[model samples]
Every structure is written in structure tokens, then in C-alpha cells.
Target: MPIGDINVPIVGKNVVIAVLVQSHILFAAFIIGAVLIAATSEYMGMVTKQPRYERFARNLARFVVLLFASGAALAITFVLALVTLFPVFFSYLQNIFFWVFLVEAFMFLGQIIIVYAWYNVWDKLAYRKNLHVVFGFIAGFFGLMAMTMIDAVASYMLTPAEAPATDVARTFLNQTMVPLNMHRFVGNFGYAGFLIAGWAGFRYLKSTREDDRAYYDWMGHWGIIWGFGFTMLQPVIGYGYMKGIRESAPDAFDRIMLDNAFTFNLLMIWLTVLAVAATGYFVHKLRFSVRPMPFLRKLAIGGLAFTALFSVLNLIPADGHIATGITFLGGEETQIPLGGMYPWKYIGLIGLMLVGFFVVALYLRASASGFHWGNASRWSQFALIACSVTIVFTMVTMGYTRESARRVDNDPGYLIYKCITLDQKVVSENCPAVSDGVNTISGREAG
Candidate 1:
């Protein structure tokens, strides 16, 4: 059978792969972050003796166990699709990343074992709380290791190292690998946290019992702390990742940042919504704080205002041209003021991070004093739901932007940057050649 021979009807091959991969990522990322959060919660429960913390940890652990199978299935489907649609490219990738794949598989197996063991022995280990918490941490560690292994492959696809493909260390430690790993590392927590908060908010609204309401309210508060706290670091880490991309693969960077700038703009808008909505939620919740801290509430309001202002600045388009190559003003490219990435966007991003830190600090301080749980206004809960929804869109937009950067003027481009084309041909000096069932690199047969 010839490679790249299979194609789906109507929707095409790329869309199928994209959908499967993206869906799998959403699940996989959530699982990684959720396990870590559950572990931390369990430990805090043991130390602080808060029954609510223990309850949340056990419930979340159950959810993670249930969700694992779906994520794994999607991942398997994605691999099968890739092999079918891009066989030659997959072959090349396999030869180069065999060790990485092996490590990832083992890590995944370890995670499954430990996570189930962690959940199943919850009652048996109640007396041994320390050991139980260790199991959860180990499971989370395994999951993170798996994610790290995969990140190497994903990052290499975008920014292949200058060294030979056989140089495993160089290939795995590509230019963008570290920043990309950090971005996703922080992002998983933010993504999972917001979803948790959203779920808790919905449950809080529906709960009829006072105890259930209180628990759900507390859960919502805890989830938002993780979500917003991690999210505040994204802009900085994301910038470092982008800088690596721009330096290593300028063409790909321009494709997303300039040619298809609308996607980037959309990302900014989603991020802005995340920041403003979260800050507003904190401010609103402050009104019901157990202690009278009117000063902090007023400061939070100001923080929210500045966050919105910075977000608007970030959302401004650099030019009138949209993704379709159409200029809105119908002239020689109309440039929008306060839109350039240099001074204005940088200012916006930096200002956002600073103000986010200030706002989050105030919120945490007030949280230490405590809040009147189960008494939150409906609007505040709705804000949490809004943040959750925006985070979903943000994730989708980011995936699309990064992947679509490989597309050159709406045409299928390289699968592994300059090395492998989308149609499965190896096109670079660094790529190996297959001759008569033997792999040859630079005229020397590979072992």
C-alpha cells in the first residue's frame, strides 16, 4: 500500500486529524492537572483537617478515573488516523522518536495503575493519609512525565533542531521545547481549574441542601484560585514560547501572527474575557466577605477597570486586513493606531500581568479572612461560568493558531516543518531517504 493514499470524504483528512487530536488534548490536559490538584487538595485536607477539602479531593479523583478512558481512546484514534493519512511522515517520526514514544507509553501505563490504586484505596488508606497522598502525587507525576515526552515531539514538529535527526537529545531538546512545555504545564491547571469552578458553580445553583450549597460554593472558590492564579502567568510564558518560534521558524510565526492575524486577535479577546471576568468575580464576591474590608474591595474594582483597559489595548488589530486578505478601509493597507506589537501590545501584556498579580493578591488576602459561602450572588456564579466558556474557546483558538501556522496561503504545508511535506515526502537535507526498504542518511545506510 502506498503512503498518503487514504483520504476522508467531504471534510478531508486534516480536519479529522485536527478534531481528534484537539479533543484528545483537551481531555489529556485536564486529566494531568486534575490529578495534581486532587493530590494537593488531599494533602491540604490532611494538614488543615478540612473535611471539605477531603471531599473535593475524593470526588475529583473519581472524575479523573472516569475521564481517563475517554482521553486514552481519543489518543489511540488520533495515532491511527495519523498513520493512515500521513504514513511516510509517521514512519519518519517513529524512527526518530522511538525512545520518546516508549517512555511515554510506560509513563501512561504507570499513571493508569497509580491513579486507580490511588482512588480504590481511598477508604483503606484513611488511617494512612500520608501514604494515600503520596500515591496521588505519584500518579500526577506519571501523567506529567507522559505530557513532557509528548511535548518534545510536538515542539520538534514546529522547530526541528539543526542537528541530525538521529541525535536524540538535540531533537528532543529543540529550541521551543522548554517554553512550550512550560506554557502547557501552566495551561493545564488553568484549564482544569476553570472547568472545575464552572461545574461547582452550576451545582451550587442547583443544590437545595444547605450543606451541599456550602460545599459547592467552597469548591468553586478553590477552583477559581487555581484557575486565575495560573492564568496570570500565561502571557509571560506564552511570549517566551512565541519568541522561540519567531527565532526558529519565522515563516511559521508570520503565518499566524501576520497573515492570519485574526486568530491571534481572537486569542487576545478570549484572554481579556478570562482576566476581566475572573477579576469581576473576585470583586463581586468580596462584597460578601466575612470580614469588613471595604478598602480591598475598592482596590479590586480599580484592578478590574485597568484589566479591561489593558485587554482592549491588546485586542486592537495592527491592520485593517483580516484573514481573508481583505482590507476593510479599501486602501493601501490601513494601519490601526495603538495596535502594533512593539510598544502597545507589549505594554498591554505587561500591564495585564502586573494588574493581574495585584488583583489576585487582594483576592487571596480577602480569601484568608474568609468569605460567606453559599451566599454568593447569582451574577458572581455566572461570571465563573463565563470564564469557563471563554477558556474553552481560548484553548481551541490557540490550538488552531499554532497548527494552522504550517499552512501556507491556505495550502497544505509541511508536517514537520521543512523536513516532511503534508503529502509524506521528505524534502530537506536533514531528512533520511528510504531506498529498497532500507533507510539511508547522507548515502550511509542507517542501522
Candidate 2:
């Protein structure tokens, strides 16, 4: 039975919707994690009477709040996209995770109210500062819980356990559920922490007052410290996630990772080194707090040196080992594995983004005199615009990846059965009598 029987839409409407929904995900994450962290820090400072921490927290929280508003709005748009584009998927998901999504919605509303109150009463609620602080934490906690609930559904979709055939709820609560949510939570913090540090550094560069600049420098150091800590923890979480996937749905995980055996290994190797290097450099830069940490420069260089080395390794051919077990692009769709091992360019794209972040951080710290409005030094503006674009585009790609990976017409064990295969001979035998894959030709019922 060939799958050419069903007239599925070209490019698949589900894929488009998934991309839109996924793209909105990162923004929601920004609001929930980084912004929440900063907000909590502000409240903590207020209660402790730590003016230095309080000031940093205040400014950082403001920035995070602005970003969070945009993120929250886009998250609503994501839900809309889900209904508009992937109607079938939306239905299945709602039915499967009905209670979870409903709870998430309530949590979102609670978070919003908390955010509004927390921000508005910064001064008004000064008398009972502890109460206000608790409000912000409430929002942050609910937001985190909502995200965690949703992750179970996402993970279930990727790793649909055999249990679903018996009990759908059991399938939704599979092995990947817990680890994936935790992995993603830490990832959000790690990415956001770095941005906050860069923001602090930019402030330091902009201010003329020595004390103000010093305060910003210290804040920037703190941000990096948080980022570095999370960065280290990220790998552990990821390993657990991958391990869960391997244990539960080895085939799907293998299709994505093992098929790109060399590229995946090489990238992992370099990123491991990069994470360690970044952590060491981050600590060194903080220890001195003078100007770029001259003594610790070697460690930064060493870290990057390894990053570059692995970048080259990633470009190497893995044909020696995983050749027959990999996939490729732009070639004949021969045997599924034998073509090649290229898991698209998404991973390398992430690497490029990290490089861009560092470059922008450098420019942000450079003096205003160094900036030329026009004819010279345009890269700074370019980096900023690029960063913004990357955020949006990456969101879209993630959505697309989620749906596209479903492989509606691929192997068995998954029920993305939108397309139905038909037997041409059987069709020829009975023409208009057939009713898709469930029924037979000659107006007879299929068993």
C-alpha cells in the first residue's frame, strides 16, 4: 500500500502552525525565567537593605519586564496559531493533555496579575516590602509550573509511549516528561543569564560616574556567574533527557542523533569545552573587575581554541562508522540511512549565535566615542538587529521542528496517521467504492 493515495496538503499545514507556535515559545520562556529571576532578585534586595544589589535588580528587572510583555503577547499568538494551523494536532493534544493545559492557562492568568501588581506597587507597597516580594515570587513560581506542565505534552508528542494504546494518560506521563522539562528550565536560565550580564556590561560602559560603572561591572559579573553555574548544570540535565529518550523511544532519538553520529559527537565535544572555558573566563573576569581581565585572558583563549578545533572536527566525515545509519539532504532518498549524516545546519547555527553574542557584548562595553553613527563601525548595530532577528527566526524553526519530526507518514508505533496509503490494484478494481484506508474496493468492508 503506497501513501500516495491521500491528497495531503503540500508542505503540510501542520508544519507551518508548529513553526509559528514554537517560535513564540522562546519569548514566553524569557518572560518566565530571566525576567522572573531579576524580579525576585529586586525583591530580595529590597528586604535585605542591600542597595547595590537592589539597584542592579531594579534596572535589570525593568529590562526583563519589557521583554516579558512582548513574550507573553507572542505566547497568546502561539496558541492562536495552534488552532488555526494544526487543527488535527490541536484536537489530539487538547484531548490527551486536557487537564494540564487548562491548569497552565489558570497559572498564566495568576502570573499576569502578580506581575502587574508587583511592578505597579514598587513604591506604593513600600511599607510591606516583604508582601510585594512574595507577590513577584508567586508570579514566577506559577509561571514555572505552567511551563513544566506543557513540557510533558511536548515530550509525549516526541516520544509517544506504547502505553498510549492502553491508557492515554499514562503515555502522556512517560519517562521523557520529567527530564525534558528540567532540561529546558535550566536552558532558559542559562541563556537569559548571559543576556542580563551583557546588559549590565553595557550599562557600565555608558555611565561616566565611577561608582555607577563599578556597580554595573559587579552586576555583570554576577549575571555571568549565574549563567556559568547553569551552563555546567545544563549538560547533566541534557544527558538525563537524552537517556530517557533513549530508554523509551530509542528509534526516534537514534534517527535524530545517532544518524548524525560524527557531527553530533564533534559538536558535543566542542560545546563541552566551550562551556567549561566560558565558566573559567567568566570567573576570572569577575575576580579582577578592572578591564577585561588581562591575567585570565589565556584561559579565554584556550577555551576558544578548543571551540575552534571541534568546529573543524564537526566538518569531518563520519562515513567511516555511521555511514549506513545516517541521513543526508539534496540527494536521492535512497535507503534511509546510507545517503549521509547531516542533521541540517541548525546546530552550527546555534554556534554562530554564541559568537555573535560575545561580539555584541564587546561593543556594548566599548565607549560611545568608539561608535560612529554612519560610515564606520556599523557592526554593533548589525549585531543587535541580528540578535533580535535570530530570536524570532529560531522560534519559528523550533515550532516547525516539533511538527515536522512527527513523520506522519514515516514508521509505525506513532499515530501521526494523517496520510492513508491505498493499494492501486485494489483501487483499479473498485474505483469510487473505496473509503480511504479503512474500507476496501467493490463496496466491501475491510477487515
Candidate 2 global lDDT: 0.53
Which predicted model would earn the best TM-score? 1
Model 1 agreement with the true structure over 314-410: per-residue lDDT tens digits: 9888877766756677522788899899999999999998999999899889988888888887877888898889999999999998888766554
Candidate 2 at residue 403, lDDT?
40
TM-score of every candidate: 0.95, 0.66
lDDT of each: 0.88, 0.53
State in Å the error of residue 154, model 2. 0.2
Q: List the residue pairs that clash in candidate 2.
A: 18-399, 19-399, 19-400, 23-395, 23-396
Candidate 2 segments whose C-alpha is farther than 4 A from its true place:
1-15, 43-48, 164-169, 206-212, 260-280, 283-405, 408-447
Q: Candidate 1: where are CA atoms >4 Å away?
A: 410-412, 430-447
What is the per-residue lDDT of model 2 for residues 43-92, given as tens digits with 9 covering 90 to 100?
A: 66876676776676556556656776677776777787656544544655
lDDT of 2 at 335: 36
